[model samples]
Target: MKKFNIFLMLIFIFTTVFTACEDKIIDTTEDKIQTSIKVTHINIPYVYNVTNESDITIEGKGFEQTDSITFIPRGGQGGGTIKLGIKTIEDEKVALENSPYFRDGEYEIRIQRGILDQLLGRTFVNRIFNASIPDREGMTVKGTVHSNGQGVANVIVSDGIEFAVTDQNGVYYLPSAKKHGFVFITVPANYEVSVINTIPQFFKRLAGLASATEIKDFELFPVNNENHVVAFMTDMHLANRNNDLTQFQSFIEDVKNVYEEYKGQNKKFYGITLGDQTWDQYWYSNNFKLENYVDQIKSLEFPIYNVIGNHDYNPYVSANDWLGAAEYRKVLGPTYYSINIGRVHYIILDNMQWLNDGGSQGVVGERNYRDFLDQEQLTWLAKDLSYITDKSTPIVIATHVPLFTNPDQNGNFNNAMENTSELLAAVSEFTNVKVATGHTHINYRNSPAGSNVYEQNIAAVSATWWWTGATSAANHISRDGSPGGYAIWEMTGRNQQWYYKSIGFDKDYQFRSYDLNNIHITSATYTPSATDEFKGKVAGYAGEFATANKNNQVLINVWGYQDNWKVTVKENGNTLPVTRVRKKDPLHIISYEMQRLNANAEPTSSFVTVNSAHLFLATASNATSTLEITVEDEFGNKYTETMVRPKAFTYSMR
Candidate 1:
């Protein structure tokens, strides 16, 4: 119904000549006779530098000396309408005394009712690209930020070391050394560049010498993404190993389904991965890397905005940490930049500082990296936010590393972000701020009391690096037992709600329950053929499930649990006692760890189950008593399970 209203509003929106009321911008049209005025085209220059350019001419026929025109911002963001005096008006063309662009976006031109009889308030404002930016002595790269054959002004272009803003003609020239081998744009609001195979071509790859001049223009498409949704895909370690390619196909299907679902609702759907799209260790050995990743993600429906994870760096570069991202910048674009989508502002960053000490060509490095926003990124973020006058606008920071530590059952965590305070201080002015990160591959949220920032450490698409489910166990799961999945963020205006979408499950599949009475994982039961050297590790991994527990305790794993979500359990229509407990999911332990041990292989430490706070323990009256469990997510989505007594715990249990 809401979507239908939007369509109706678009169909019947009234636009016309202005009214005499100076303070109020009229919305209704005038009922006067129309005039025949033809505008061949407006000749706003291809580029304009503010220092030397000021006047912009509008071409066409009908012109009046006292015509009033106003430039109104799209989305009602920036400010109100901007008005300038008309220098000369003629039937052929008119020149306006224009000033520097105070804002960056698409604006509408509204003329006084009488001046434009038939065509008054419905025309789009032509942007004037010109600033007084002087050219450096030696300019190596030049480019234009254009859309629909018109130059875009105030669009920032950078070559890693130096930054330049487009002139009145939408032209930018950087006196760059070409060290980064590419020039990328910040991607101004309301416009997007070309996307090839789901990749936004926001940056151009430099082909020649640093001193040679290069011309690269960025073309953007105008879109109304005010009502859109973003799917946050993180840590999909697709390295062509462990049947990850096959597993990724299933992920693609899930994304296609989501795209269709949102498309039906008239919402613009987009996908942004929060890094670790490929395993660097297997870049050479497996002959699979970011290029392979691009091919895999090509099947996705929306344009892919990427974040550089720690594992995405070159295992061969040892000189500088940022140098490791040379390939990433070449393939994906800027390591840090900002883009506006609708009312929300998004900032993509590369927080991982790669430090592969022993790295050399053909020899993989340690692949070690620290997690924190570098000083350069912090500085860029501040400048980006300064343009956003509305402090209440939603700001989403997408990076590879999370700002907070993994919390236990009670939500207590230790050893948080390395530079959380500094990063937070940069965004302290914003009222609505959210930080979305991957790396942990576990689902958790941290919102300190009295703090404005809400950090949600999302789950991974390749659950446990595509291990458990790839095997005969047939269960794709994360370290916290959250199903291998991505997050679906629904943003309409400033109101945003997100859900963790487990692959092959409905949106309501928010939690899983285990009949603890039947969950007894003995070494002889799960891994009877374990080698003598690794047989002792079974009990260490199984925890309480190593022994029998017939206390009628039912364990529930709400992997997507946020602090505000509710959990309730009842037996025979009567309420049962429920306690939130920090426990490793028994099912994951049996699926990943036991499977590895049975094969006489050491379990990867990172793939093992970790104690999470999303677990809930409920006590029933007897072994034969039935139980009803219902979990409610923060968004009020309810997931319930009615379990009969003596429910069996098996490898395939849901």
Candidate 2:
């Protein structure tokens, strides 16, 4: 009976063990549930100067093979596929369209599986995804003071609205503005704003547009009781042994001659070398000394105020061991300091990086041995300007760069100061203000035309276009290779005038002055071809519009890279009548009609629409005869081009 019981117990134990094992396996399989991964949105950070992708690690797990990944933008737009495995995790680039430039919102990434083919072992699944690519905003307004192109710590700065002193390296920060606005320094008494007159205008608006924004980069003209004729020049880029420097002496001679001529007639004159007065050849070498440069500048008879340029700072000369101010101090004075000439206040600014070309010029003054402006100077500027009781006293602001467009349309003037908008608001409260600057070789004059102030950009007195030869065939020379010029600004009682006169080494100096009273583009005319396929070239009277034949279309190429191409035929700003063409068709000999305002018949650029004219031309291979083209400018400048249609016979008709 016991043997029977034992057999029964063994059978029972075996059955229980088998049942328990089966239950455990079922529970483990149930715990492994499908996750159904879906990518909702991908956030890509904003990048301006940087070329690489800001945020690369894409979120959303459970990426299945053969799944379709579609990118859907927020606004009404088409979708695109996301090519995976093509780019490694390390190498990813955010395309321009997907960047903060145009699209700045969430995007849906839809993923679907089993749509094209059947899954091997898993069940069919569909997943929807979305991700946000936020728009990159502009940086806040910050100020960094620099001395000797190096930061001098603890400089105070006030934008008249917000005030902050720079830290150890002469850096300060304030809130940013919504749009591109003007700003000036409440400069301390001992220190001056880089450009005191017009002030540095910061442009935060129109970012990432088809064209880069145009902000004034230099200082404005001086406005005081003195009817002074100041000669302004900068970015000479003079090396100790270069031909451009040789030509610069000639410019000085010309200025001296002009001043002497005026002086002989009992006229008053003054001069200011904006910055970069001398190219420090000793930047990396100890062979040359600061006294060598100072001696050369002292050669000029008149008292020339020198604004500190980047080249003034020498790397070989240690800033900490040497004088507090760089070697330039002996010749140019304090880097962030200012000078008062008669009723006008002059502020010399340092805007280069604190470190060398290889390093980044930090917002704070201390990081780089390079470009910066400190707090002490900014404090002095505010205190000094505050003392001026007469708000009408015209302020003449000067700097290496204008607050707007520098040499090319790409440069900005308010680079060093963070509180540029606040400073501009302060200056805007004043009645009269003007900003003038150099560094850019090109000349730009802005008056109440587009904005609310007057600004002037002076041309370089040194090498123009880096003395790049006209063509590759021409060897690259220095000043002899390009045009070198200086400016003579006349500050009168009622209005201010700027004369950008190019004084070549030996050529006769000429003066070109502009005023708001007579700002217009005159006549713009083009000739058409006779053949069915318009085959001809069009010429114009002005420099802006030229003649060209493209795809049997006579195109009067209007609009320069800097400004639009518009023309008028008379002295008074008026447009002539124009003939209409096809609806929105590429223009062909078109016209823009304008009513005459005055009887002055003298031809000026304000009387006709140069852009309104257009002409069609035949294709190059389909031409049969000679096409004549003519264009005229308001200044009576005429250009002509002929397009010879291809003839069937090789020989001439004659």
Candidate 3:
């Protein structure tokens, strides 16, 4: 019995031992199911200012549409796990700035791909080291890192110099480097540095005062709080009939995009169209139906104002200046008007009959143009100005014909104006004024009247004149450079900022202020020896009203070499209005009733003539009397033996 009992005990003990060993073997087999993933690399952690450090960006190839990344503090204190939020495939940016669950400490960043309904994807685990960087020498460098926490091996840390790649494990060491320093990775392709809290482009190196330097904390630039105003328009000329509707619609869409971006902002913005709203080149018929045009504009969220361009009135163009004033009034509200926005007032003037007189067309001669703004319109303007006396109000004058030009000094085609004296007189009474126009399919800005009145001539949206050439005078280039774009004006305090961005020219295109700082009265001068042609030079005042008061009697000294030339005071080309105070002395106290005269009359054949013996007279004084004078040409272009004055002025003064 004793022998049998002993044997049974031995058997039981053996069975127990064998079962325990089997169980242990099975547990070890199950543990092998979870494959350990080796983190191939951990990029440099993004470092923003250490103070408000919040958003953290960790980029790598393993992230997917539905992956969850959890961040945990490696050793605890002030650390916690943060789950990654939804990821977007577009823009490819992970916004971690708003996440509040993470703490400042060494963190274990682990990402797991694929979830409940999907198959397994890759997994990654990385350690993030956060430490405060002190100022050294004259620089302060803030830094962060990702590693396996062991002596990081095979790691590379660069002060942008002397690259030091680590050993086998991912370990990096930034040795005591320069005082004021810069450190950036020699990032291999497919790898990106942490760009978070840094400049927008992260791959670039990091820079700052060194650890031993006394550093000043960086203060972020103030945000732009000023409201933005964008002027939008399309189908300006309706160059080609077939292309009109599409171009018009596209313009409205572009404007809509601008309005959508700044809808809630306080800056009030709108659009303006300089008529021709339809293609009217060939047919007297309306370009695209007006209903369609209005529908397109109504699609825009902002209000739009229109001015009748020539094409809009081509129906009556043959009669009295294309579509006459009565028709223009019926089609697009008033031909001229005014509106006020904020402290700025805008005056819209109609200049369709630009060639009413026999002078050059377009920009050069103003007399040839029909009574552009009729007497009725001029009266309205005076009334408008009477109400607009506040010198503080900024005024913008808009017309189809730009009032200034940089034309070669003698070009007869320079269509600025024959009667601009009246306009300048009216405008000089105000403090802040600007003028804008577009008839030249080019982008040019000039202040012929006065630089203080910012004058801008926008480029044409359509390159109709030069549609086929390798090089055209229109000054247009490729698509981004063409199909044209608009200007964005932003006002902050008393400063007016202008930015011209081409269509599709990157979202960041901005208007640059070109040397407008030292703008003051002392920087300019007024001169009385100023004529349409022999305008005397005024220092620092390129485009200025050279007016002198007779009471002030500021003498303007002028010199003429030849004889038969006598200088005298006059008004509107009339020697009658001119009071002869002194001869030989060019200096004269300018009376408000100032007349323009020249030693001789240079007859230009290019100008249209109403009669056989005459060219259009620009000033009224020369119209009454046939002023006979010797004509001379320095270039020796054919000169008539003697120039004869015409019987009548261009068109009777409007």
Candidate 4:
């Protein structure tokens, strides 16, 4: 009887262990199935009524009860995740409604699930036509979105408050409300609106909408080729100065000359201006004068895309953030937009935010400037990028202010975008991306933390704010001593190459060099100072050294220097190591000092010098021999300049 009892106990223990192991295997398989959710189809209307909530249904596989739906509205309205009203988890179908606050515009929807933070699927929806009645008798506005003379369907067209999607024939219509001046379209992927006179022709004014009915049609061209070239020029800052307009004309001539060369190669060329098209913002009272600048830019025959700068804002406008760009929108259309060229996607964003402080101009006084991209713009960016099917496509982001830059000694970031991390995060999935900006009037390149993307800060065309010193050789010299220049980027397949072109210099003139002896300084002796007194002395010393002996170190500023570029100094068939140093340009210091000592200096010559990132230093032996400097830009273009070492001079200062 004892043996039989023990046998029963053993059987019970073995049965329990086997059951536990079987349960573990089943759970593991179930978890794998749960996470393998696949979205097959989503049933959503192309357009919705702004005032009415419509049911949205999504169909997929492996959706669980833990999954949630999120709707992101475009045009600056932030969206939130929605509570599932009716869900069939087993069928993988979920239904939700548009948020009550959703306006008449475009929106994005996403399916999210699990603690691992996964996005199951995403799509876009457009809320067409205004829900509210028009203040005045409504006029029917109709238009068709066409690409290459063929109607393109499902394009979103809007009049700020009301949006409509083009039908199968690419035709759309909306009842125009009172005070609606323009009817524009959210340009579709792979197609761009007609650009006329450097201004994007995406909208038609209401003046042509006489008698309650207007017919407007948009023409979009294809830029889907693999080889294309883009010309980036910024900070024209055109004003009523003595030579400002003439300088702009000369810059245009240079662009024409360059474009002609590219045209000969049969390369497609596109032009983009980063911002600060006018300096009239200096007098906030004369905000209307911006119209003059707009007209002048519109006179350019080529279609030069533009982004908004702080100087483009109307200081007197007292509206909210969305309406703050009213005047700019009236002239420049959308402040943010996107276009596609070949495998490259280009996005232009307006990073300037109005403070509503009624300040006279930008970059003056403490707390004068703030950089931010409104939540709406961020939402738009996400939605726009979603439509892109190619994950490996390269993207080019252009804005007026740099998205990333080094802060000042006080930990202040006056020149960089405050939300850089967020922007970088949004584009992190894109492997090949670059940002181009113009505002500092200095040329430099920087890559933000957490990403390998590079942001190139192109120098201004109106260098030193149109300030030309009487003794200076060039009318426009940036405060950092970089010649006023623009950048030309050539994209072939997945590869891109760029070079900075100085306004009056040859294409090969990528950098400038100086004799350290003439500047009377070595990297060891040169110290950066913030005090006004010391700065004044340094400026004077630089001016005096320009005419002194030239027998010491060689300093070179490669305007478009990047980490990949190779710079070296050779003397007597021996190569010397070059040290990268943060030093202000000696020529810029001399220009500033000359302006201070000689009151006859041009008004634009008063710019303060800032540290240059591209400056390289190397010492040479005191032998009077030819010092050869060689620079190879990232594109493999080699530039060489030879300077003769001068005899050492001994000067005794009393």
Off by over 4 Å in 1: 1-142, 160-179, 206-215
Off by over 4 Å in 4: 1-142, 147-149, 154-168, 172-192, 204-216, 221-226, 282-288, 318-324, 359-367, 406-415, 449-452, 469-475, 520-551, 600-606, 647-654
- The C-alpha stretches of model 3 lying farther than 4 A from their native spots are 1-235, 239-242, 264-266, 283-292, 321-323, 354-371, 406-415, 449-451, 465-483, 492-494, 507-654
Q: State the local distance difference test value for candidate 1.
A: 0.79
Query: How close is each model in CA RMSD to the real structure?
Result: 20.2, 25.1, 27.1, 25.3
Worst 10 residues of 2 by lDDT: 122-131
lDDT (Cα, tens digit) per residue for candidate 4, span 250-310: 7778888888888788777778889888663453433334566766665454567778887
Global lDDT of model 2 = 0.40
The CA lDDT of each predicted structure is: 0.79, 0.40, 0.39, 0.66
| Residue-level lDDT tens digits of model 2 in 241-350 | 43444555666677767667656754345567666665554333434444454444545544455666655565433334123234564334344444445456555565
Query: Clashes in each model (backbone N, CA, C under 3 Å)?
Result: 25, 118, 45, 3
Q: For candidate 3, lDDT tens digit of each residue in 1-654?
A: 999999999999999999999999999986674353322334534332233344455544334556565665442222245676644432334433335443333345565654322212222222234333343343233233333333333323344223444445433344435421333332221222321221111112223324432111111112233343637242355534534445445545665677676666655565665455544433333334343345445555554556565545433233355324444443344566664444456677776563323222122122233425555556656666665547666777777666665232121123364455566667777877777666554444555433356566654444332231112112222111222455556555445655443544433332111111111111122223345443332221222223321221111111110112232333334443212122111111010011111211222222111111001112223222333222221222221111132221111100
What clash count does candidate 1 reach? 25
Candidate with better TM-score, 2 vs 4: 4
Candidate 3's TM-score? 0.38
How many Å off is the CA of 163 in candidate 2?
A: 18
Better of 3 and 4 by lDDT: 4
The alpha-carbon deviation from the true structure for residue 52 of candidate 1, after best TM-score superposition, in angstroms, is 28
